[model samples]
Target: MYCKNCGSALDNNAAVCIHCGVPNGHGERFCSNCGAEVAPGAAVCMACGYSLSAQKVAAPGAKSKMTAGLLGIFLGAFGVHNFYLGYKGKAIAQLLITLLSCFMLSEVSAIWGLIEGIMLLSGSINTDADGNPLGD
Candidate 1:
């Protein structure tokens, strides 16, 4: 393996880079697969075919999973929980489904939101729209 932080080669079992002191899998400067310098925000390495989509993990989101799940369960027909979770597109779709149909189709969106709520509470849907892990 290679140190993503420093482009230095590392032992497969090493926990940190001996040259840079960075913990394994902690940096974005270089590809861990090929040790090639990576561009900022690049999803894949140009030098190698290794996937880099999951390179960085943002800090846990401030939105609470309980809060979101509860909102989805209670006011999911209006997609209030999705709005709070930054899932504006899904929220708008749900809201529009209820509004455009004059509540006739509200149950569809309601069921959708309810399922999402349950998933959230069950840890099946743990990330926000930004892909940040939800806070407990």
Candidate 2:
């Protein structure tokens, strides 16, 4: 691996470059795959033929933690927070648990959602289903 900002060699698991302070995947001066200096705003690296624009990610959503927490706290029985966070399976499960049981089991879902909401607010659950970091 290489530091994208300075073209310095880096460990594969490094989050930031040691030589340069830039985050591992945040720079444009160097090619991430080959550590070759790339032209400014170049779409492809000429040295090793690598795509510069593409990022290794699972579809970041930039979701807000506050909104998700509030939803989980207020409408957790309906799985609104989970739905907002892109956890469709969990949301549907909570919704079904509340509806199919005729609201008798609503507290179960509510408590579950409430716990998850608290976790989110506390930064324990920092990422959404797509592994995107939640915004403050």
Candidate 3:
């Protein structure tokens, strides 16, 4: 193997580059398959025909669409759905709005959350704050 960041040879089991201190598969400057220099953001390596346009892998613990939607529908006034979706600001807003108004404005927050929940269930809001797709 080779370090894509520095074009230096790497052990087969190595996880990082000894020369540049970059992790394996972490750069676009060189071909990992052939250790040849490649243009930045190039889809294919000209020297070895290696494909570089790999799809981004989703995180293992991605949020669930059903859970988020249900939370939004049931506890939207408290911003539970937003919190689960990593939308801290929106969650805090909803929570504060409901709390500050002593439940007088809870209906407004609930409506907002219900709309967001519907959007999530309908696939309009598919991704989380980190851009990871919500799970089934």
Clashing pairs in 1: none
Estimate the lDDT of model 1: 0.85
Query: Model 1 RMSD to the real structure?
Result: 8.0
Distance from true position, residue 46, model 3, in Å? 39
Better of 1 and 2 by TM-score: 1
Per-residue lDDT tens digits for candidate 2, residues 1-136, read: 8998999999999988999788878878999899999986665689998967456322444888899998999899999999999999999999999999999999999999999999888666767888776776
TM-score per candidate, chains pooled: 0.58, 0.57, 0.57
What is the alpha-carbon RMSD of candidate 2 to the true structure?
12.2
Model 1 per-residue lDDT tens digits across residues 16-132: 899999999888889889999998656668799676655444365467889999999988999999999999999999999999999999999999999999888866676788877
C-alpha RMSD in Å of predicted model 3 compared with the true structure: 9.0
Candidate 3, poorest ten consecutive residues by summed lDDT: 51-60
Scored by TM-score, the top model is: 1
Candidate 2, residue 68: lDDT: 93
* 66-136: candidate 3 lDDT, tens digit per residue: 99999999999999999999999999999999999999999999999999998888666777877787775
Instruction: Identify the superior model by TM-score, candidate 1 or candidate 3.
Output: 1
lDDT of each: 0.85, 0.86, 0.85
